[model samples]
Target: MANYHRNNVENVVLGRHHHHSHRSKSASVAGHTFRLWNAASFRRIIFDAVSCGASSRYAARSNISDEKQHLQQKQQHHKTTSMKNNAKSEKLSDLLSIAEAETDVETKKKEEKLEDLKRLVKELQQHEEDSTKNKKSEAAAKVRLLAKEELEVRGTLAMLGAIPPLVAMLDETEQNDVNSLVSSLYALLNLGIGNDANKAAIVKVGSVEKMLKLIESPDGLDSSVSEAIVANFLGLSALDSNKPIIGSSASIYFLVRTLQSLDDESSPQAKQDALRALYNLSIFPGNVAFILETDLVVFLVNSIGDMEVTERTLATLSNIVSTREGRKAISAVPDSIPILVDVLNWTDSPECQEKASYILMVMAHKSYGDKQAMIEAGIASSLLELSLLGSTLAQKRASRILEILRVDKGKQVSGSYGLGAAVSAPICGSLSGKPDGGGGRECFEEDEEMMSEEKKAVKQLVQQSLQNNMRKIVKRANLPHDIVPSDHFKSLTLSSTSKSLPF
Candidate 1:
């Protein structure tokens, strides 16, 4: 019985030992899992904070720059589109799809519409060509007419392969049947107006050269037909790309010849169109040399007395004086200075006045003889007033010329007042005698007509002052009122009488 009791006690102790060790192992595993989870969560929070600070500024700058560039590109594209197209009358129901309220949607529609129109024009051209090739001139003509309408409606779309056949039609038409030729040329003209792309395409297909030949040729072409062609040519020169090509083709010389050749009584409008085209072509520096090569300057100089031609001529001469060669060419003309002075004298349009002033200003700036010629032609007083009275652009240009004129006169009046008396002289007639230097304008006298309203008013005031001062002189000298001859002396003085005595 003692041995059995000892064995049961030993078994109970071993069972208790095994239960405590298993519980301890489970507690250690739970503690290790909690530590690992805490570490991972802490690492994630710190990583997020660092990323927010470090990457956000650079990323934001990059994003903003990208967005700004995109907006600029979008705006430029929009402007180009607007310049080339007229907005179609979108249907009321279609407003939701095309309205600017939904910018992205509307923009996509415009792009798609432009693309569709281009494709349509291209197809029309192809059909026209195929029909014409098949000897189906009637169908070809109809297709061309439709293409012309579409091109007019969609301006730049004329560029998409439509100009080629239209130009070819001009050549293919019977020389004697100018009526049919007129239709084709008119179609091309409508297709080209304000459509810069069409101009590039036209130049590419040698239409300019063809038109040059057509105009130069004696087809006994109708005046209206010639006018349409010239007007269209004028429109095409509105494109910068066409200017260099047109200039190189001797368009300037021939165009001037055409003007001179046209009967003055017939096609007056055609003459104006030719002048305008010449003016537009003059905008290019390359064309300046070509224009100077012809007698166009002489034509322009002679036309200056006519108010209608003066404005256009002045605009052309303005561009011409921008270069050394042009200055020489203009000054080289015998009547150039007088013509410019005439424009300033009689023209009532402020725009024309501004152009004339600028041309004179450029000439005066270019050479000594040119400056002297301007003064001799009596332009200084007009320009001085123009500086104060003209448009903002005109004001700046005239002011600059006046400033130079003052300096030129200052040198001439070395002994008049102070060293720079001419600079301070308020009027062209401030000094009584002729300028020692010739580059300045003629000094005003007591009796000649005033060219400007301001000068006219001032002259009236001067006349009143001279009469009053003469009456005072007669009273002070105790002479008879009738013997004073105040009526004869009303507009004169010792200096003024001498000025008027020549009359």
Candidate 2:
């Protein structure tokens, strides 16, 4: 029993010692593990703190750099704006300076002109007061200067009493005063141009009568002096108020004489001026009686072929044809209608065509004989061609004439037959089989042959007209007459038909 109890106690003591030792070992191992884990966490925290510090430094540096760059941009922008402003300022200054300089120049020119005019007036007055040759020559020089000046300067001089002296100078009869006369005459002419008040003032001052006196003077004037007088007439006649005043005072005769003198050694310019003056005078219908008193209508009709003065001549005739007497005068000419129709083929001068057509239209509308004359002159084909390929105005006129002819045709047919014949008329030829004298068949055959012949004749007329017109057009274009192929011309002729003709 004692041994067993002793064994139990030993066993219990051994178990207690073993359990305590295990407990102590486990506690030591746990403490070492905790220390290792704490060390790892601390290292991680240190690394993260270093990373945050570096990020803050980088952010600060970036902000500073951005601020500096922004400052540079602001400075550059301000500099660029200042430069643009300065450039604009310089440009504006230059423009302003240039404008001021121009204004000053204009003012200076005006002052100079005023001074020159005053000097001219003084010189003219001196010449008027003193009849010495030197004074006259100086006065003549001033008049010549006045001729070259514009309307404004001439107006100023006239207001300063410069024209009466010039007029007085016109009465000089001495041969030595010829130059002074020419100077005064031309100065007066220049003063009248483009200034109606000056024109009226001049005519009021007896310029026309003075010129007529010079023209009719016993000692016949030289050609140059005559031209100067005609030029004066032209300048005066431009005014409608002066047309009658000048046209009634033997000016028309002088103008016609001047135009006639063109065939001689007279200046062509004088003829042109006379034509223009006559045209102006002719525009007044009452003046047509005076113009018809002269052979101007014949002269104008004959001169229509003159290419140099064709437009003016036609323009004058256009005015002449407006009056009843004028129309009779034109139609009285043997070939006036023919000549006007020929002008329709003048493709080279559309102006000539328009004026000629206008004259014809006026005549044809007023006089039935004129329409027949135009039709007999072969105006239909020419009108057709014109309508197809003419200027806008020419085309309109051509179409109008065609309409007139078309409308007049019915009137002509109706007039030839009695207007009161309402019943149907039988055919003139016998329809019965009974044979009578050969007159009926022969007349019917003759009528048919006449129609066929007329158709062929009209075709030939159109072809001939086309050829002549084409040749004229070629000549005017400065090309060879045969530049257009004959075959093409034939095709054109073939395409044209008298059946379609309104006339």
Candidate 3:
């Protein structure tokens, strides 16, 4: 039983060992399955991890590209903003330059305007200062009556020195002020200072030209202005050296016209004054020709015909006839002889007759036998007729002509005859006969008429003797003593048988 129990124990122990072995196997299998499952799970997890890693890398790359794009856009925006700022800066610079240029131009204009205003103000101030100084000096000079007059004279002289201002006053639009100024200037000129410098100053002021305009103005002038102008011109005329001023063509023509326009009936004094001025002007040789070139000759000749104008006209004619130019001027007028003869015939005044006869004598001297030519031109008979009613002046002038002819005849008789003698002799011989009345004499009712007629007869005799003597003088002038008589009076008797009168 022990043996069996031991065996059973062995069996039981074997069975237990087998069961332990099976369990050991089952545990091994389970451990292997678990190991395989863990391996697969780990492999799967690794794969998943790798895949996720790749996806995350791709996402990161896309995110990086987006970030780069955003950065580039921001850079472009910054560049555009910077360019706009630069453009604004350039525009502001251009506007600033234009504003500066405009400001400079306005500033220059203002400066120039300021300069002009300063100059004008300076001139005005100077004028006021000079005027005030003059007034003060004048007040200081007024001490006594004689002293005052002396001071007044000095003041006038000073004012005359201030001719620039006085003349400028003429341009003022105010008429009364202009007149007063002009009047003051006239008084200054007439102040008997006789300062050549002052006179020259007045001339420089253009007062002469202005005064002439006042005379010619259609509106006329105040009497004082007229008188002053006349006086000024007369004073200037007396300054013979100033005669060149008359050559100013405008001045000369105006003076001539002014003289012509004066009515002898209305303003005889003015006429006389004008005549005197003309006479003064005539003293200039150039003015003589200029006067003749105008209607002055005709006007003067017409004036001579007027009773009122006779004396002055004669005086003027005498002045004109004294020069070589005067001779030419007298000869220029074709009707001068007849006009002069008529003047002689109408006037019984000694002075008038003397002047007329003197003019004739001058003509005789110039014309020689042309005196006969004048008679043949119908002037000689009238001249002889005029001589029949001569005054003492006429007789003297007539006798003077005869004496000249006689001297000429004495010289000419050295030759038998000359054209001058031949022309003069017959006209002279014709006067040797009696008058139309009996006994070679005529009676007149009026004592004055008789005196005139007697004077005329004496003039005629003198003229005849002059003509005969001129013939002898012409004949003798070209001849030897043998061919022509030394004494012409002894050679030829007064007879109609000698030669026929040309006329």
Candidate 4:
């Protein structure tokens, strides 16, 4: 039993050992499986962990890649923004340049406007200065003119005193100083000192010729210079009639030509002086026929119409009709009697009235027709009225005409009245009854018949006389008389009438 039990125990021990080995192997395999499984699980867990870790790592790597890509995208976006910012800065710079150019153009326009204003102001200032200068020049010219006038007056006074030095100074003076010189010469001529000897001295010095030449000079010699020259020449002409200094033919021609030349429209004073010179020349019997043959009578008649010198003209006409030659010269005119009668009736001035009356008296003494014409012209009645209504000079002239007419009437009883018989009968009345009647009574009846035959003859004669008188008055007053003076008269005997000449 012990043995068996031992055996069993061994067998059990072996079986147990076998089993334990199997169990150990199984446990080992299981442990291996468990280990494998654990390992696998661990490996799975590890792998999962690893895979998770790897995935996490990969995720991390992916995240890192995404972050890097995002970072790259952000970098690209930042670059684009920087580029846009740069472009905006460039556009602002261009706009600033345009504004600067516009400002520059505006500044230039303002500057130009300022310059234009300055120029206008300067021109205005210049114009004002020029106006002031012109006014000053005008004032200076007036002052100079006054000074020249005063100097002439003083020089004239000195020359009249017979100051030799003053005369010499005038001779040596420049032509521009002729105003004073001419004034002095005029005064010396008026003084009438040192008669023939002084005149001879002046002629020797060529003063007469110089004075003549001065008429055409531009120095504005006075009208008196012409008068002085005329007097000097006339005196010289009279003094040496046999030995002419300025040649007799030349002198006469020059005088006549000068008289005509003085009739220029610009020279009133020259015309007056020329007329005076002609009057002096006419007084010379030697020149009377020559003057009458020329245009001297017409010129004188025209001068009678001059307003500036009618008084001198009337005196000249009166002087012309007084002498025998003068009467003949006057009769040569176509209508002299009517003209003179007209003058007598028209004027109110005492001097003019006297002159007209004087002419009428002379005409009445000339011929039977002249007396008859005067009577028919109402000149006889006009004379009577004038005698009643005139001054002493006019009344005396009218009385003379009446006496001449009375003489003419008395002469008509004897025969055809001669001028001498007509003049003598009224003064003495002795010739009135004288038996010297030739054709005078017949001529008287014929004159009466002729006077009655013409229609309104007496009225016409009176009307013409009054009209002519009005014209004479107008001429004397320097006015125009276009209307007939007789148009206002109503009477037959005392009224203005037209006269017809029997001759």
Candidate 5:
């Protein structure tokens, strides 16, 4: 029984050992599982941290890049703006510099002009103090200088009392003094260019008489002296107050003479100057009589077609034709009406055409003989053409002239046919041209055959009369007999009459 109890105890101990060993193995497994779980959680946490850090760093880098780009854009904009400002500043500086340079040049020119004027004044004063030959030469030089001066400078010299001395120098009387006189005359003329006061002063100082004396000297006048005189007259007579003074003197004679003497050597400018002076003088009605005394109407009429002087010459005639004496003078010229009528054909020169029309209108209105002359000059064709193709004013004048001719004819016809009872032709036939006067017996003849014979005789007579009238018109127009085509003329039945003509 003791052995059995010990075995039992051993078995119990083995069982307890087995139980303890199993419990230790279970503990070891649980501890190992816990450690593995902790390690897995740590690895996951570390991975999440690394991901967050990487994302934050990338965001920082992007922000830095954006700031840098913005900075670059600002710098570029600032650089462009600075360049534009610099360009504008440079341009402004250049413009300012140019303006300053131009201003300096103008200032220098003004100072130089002032100094030149002072020198001229000093020279003029010295010239006034002496009359020696050297002084006379200096006087000539001074006058020559004054001639080239502007109107203001000439006026200034004139106001300094230069004119009377210049006129006094005209009496130098030496044969060599002609040049000085001519110079003085031109200087005087230049002074009177735009200064009326100087013009009056020059005339008041006997410059005109002095110039005339030089011109009318026993020695024949030089062409140069005559030219100077012409320029003086042109300048002096521009003033209305001086017109009669110049015209009443021998100046009109000289002007007309100058115009008449247009030689190869004569400058066209001189001729124009003479015409302009005459035109100025002709403005005064009193001067026209003096102009007529020079017998200029014929010359003016002959010169009407010269294009260079046509306008002024016609203007003079226009002024002249305002008076009865002028109209008679113009009408006395053989070719005046014809020449004036021809001007209407100058389509290119409307001014000349207008002036010529004016002269014709005046002459026609004043004189009946002028009307016949215009008709004789074949003005009818020209008038018809002008009425159709001329300027507005020309058409009006042409129409007016045609009306005058037509109205005058109507008056003459009415006066001749009114109650005077010179003769009346029957409707069928007339006895006016017959040698035997047909009494009331012929009026009663009503046979158709006899009436037809009478009609044929009357038609022959009418055709003869028409030919005679046409010949007269053609002869008066100075046209060729065949001017109208023969067939065209034959086409005109007796139905057409002189009354149907443009004239």
Candidate 6:
């Protein structure tokens, strides 16, 4: 037991010695590192001292070992390299940090801009709904400005569910209230200017009738408002489905009255707008007879010299004279045939040329073929050009008319058959009794007698005034009034009720 106790004491002594030795070794390495750094400074001092005595061999004989000096220089170089590497890493870290910070700032700025756009759109929509008049007007002006940038916004309001409410907003305003009314029109115009779906949506909400009613309001409503309504109507009616709806008899009649109310001599813009609306409405063939009942046919035909009005005028007439009664009514206007032929030279539009050519073709088939007035108005040459280069339909009509006009009169007298000759037969039979040697006026007077009392007075007055105008227009064209304007000048025929023309 005593030997074992002695053995444990000896082991403990040995362990302590081992730990002390290891601690001493670590301390020695640290001391050596510090001393090496100091030795570099001392070597410089000692070299200076030796240089003062000029003793190179004495400096080499100093106490420091060569291996220890080499070790000290190695350690110093390693420490300097490590510090330079750390400094370079710190600079790179700073640059990376700056770049990351700049990227974060740009991302936040973009997010803020997007948020501002959303807020602006939402605010404008809210302003549109405000109860206060000023707020509503402000919203309207704002939204109008926004919609003006439709390419930028692309119906952003549509994304925010603002279109239908805007359509309904038109219902809340009075046509007489200029601010409220104009605002609604502006919004609707912008809204309708969106994609086809947006326009179809506007139409789906029954805007055609609303716009027409605003248009039909008396001249007392602000002209700007009326003009806006007409402009909006034009855009909406551009859709084919909207055309039939707005082209109803009542609306066409209203449009014609609107035209009559505008003085072509003074209010040219008003006349242009109203006439264009009527022109668009005339696309529906079913509405032609209703338009005929109004004095609009004579009105439009008379106004054809206005370049602003001529294209639409000829276009509407092209649709009108497509009907049998329409051709006869249009034939009654002294300026109609001549004006249609003149459109070919003055207008650059091929459609205008085609329409005018087609009208001449129809008139030739009905009455104008045999008339020296149509031939004098330069119908022959226009028909020739269109016969060759016009649309296929216009080409066919022009070819037939040329045959009628170019063919021998002896064949016509003998009832020789052609499309124009066939069409002229029915109208010629009706015109044979007129004062123009057509023998048709006595029949017109008889038909006039059969009309209602109110109709008789209006018809006589309109007839007398128109006859005077016809005489002047015919004289200006240097043609006999009796030849160009057919004798049953101011009357509607009750017998010809067919929608399609006799042709």
How high is the lDDT of residue 12 in model 2? 52
| lDDT value for model 6 | 0.62
lDDT of 2 by residue, 25-127 (tens): 3333534311122577557656655666677789899999999999999999999999999999999999999999999999999999788777766666564
Q: In terms of lDDT, which candidate is strongest? A: 2
Model 6 misplaced stretches (Cα beyond 4 Å): 1-131, 152-154, 174-176, 213-219, 263-267, 338-353, 366-400, 406-503
TM-score of 6: 0.52
Instruction: Return whichever of 3 and 5 wins on TM-score.
Output: 5
Lowest lDDT sum, 10 consecutive residues, model 5, at 413-422
* TM-scores vs. true structure, each candidate: 0.55, 0.64, 0.46, 0.41, 0.63, 0.52
* lDDT for each residue of candidate 3 in 1-503, tens digit (9 for 90 to 100): 34434654565566556656665433345344111235785576567666666777898999999999999999999999999999999999999999999999999986774554344223322343545534322322221122224534433433424445444433332344334544444544554245555556656667677666665677756555555555566666766666667445455665566577645322555556667777777777777766666777667766677777787787677767766667666766677766776666554466777787787778677666535534434444344444444665576566555444433553421011111222111112223365554422333234345434444443444446445555544654775434533466434333322122221
lDDT of 6 by residue, 77-137 (tens): 9999999999999999999999999999999996775565566455445634336555555
Candidate 1 per-residue lDDT, tens place, 35-137, comes to: 1225785576567556665677778899999999999999999998885553443455478666666898778987886676566555435534445433323
Q: Could you arrange the candidates by lDDT from highest to lowest? A: 2, 5, 1, 6, 3, 4
* Local accuracy of candidate 4 as per-residue lDDT tens digits, 397-430: 7777766654444452211122112222222222
Q: What RMSD does model 1 have?
A: 21.8
Better of 4 and 5 by TM-score: 5
Worst 10 residues of 2 by lDDT: 413-422
Whole-model alpha-carbon lDDT for candidate 3: 0.55
CA RMSD of each candidate after superposition: 21.8, 13.1, 31.0, 33.5, 14.4, 22.6
Error of 3 at 391 (Å): 8.7
- In candidate 6, clashing pairs total 10
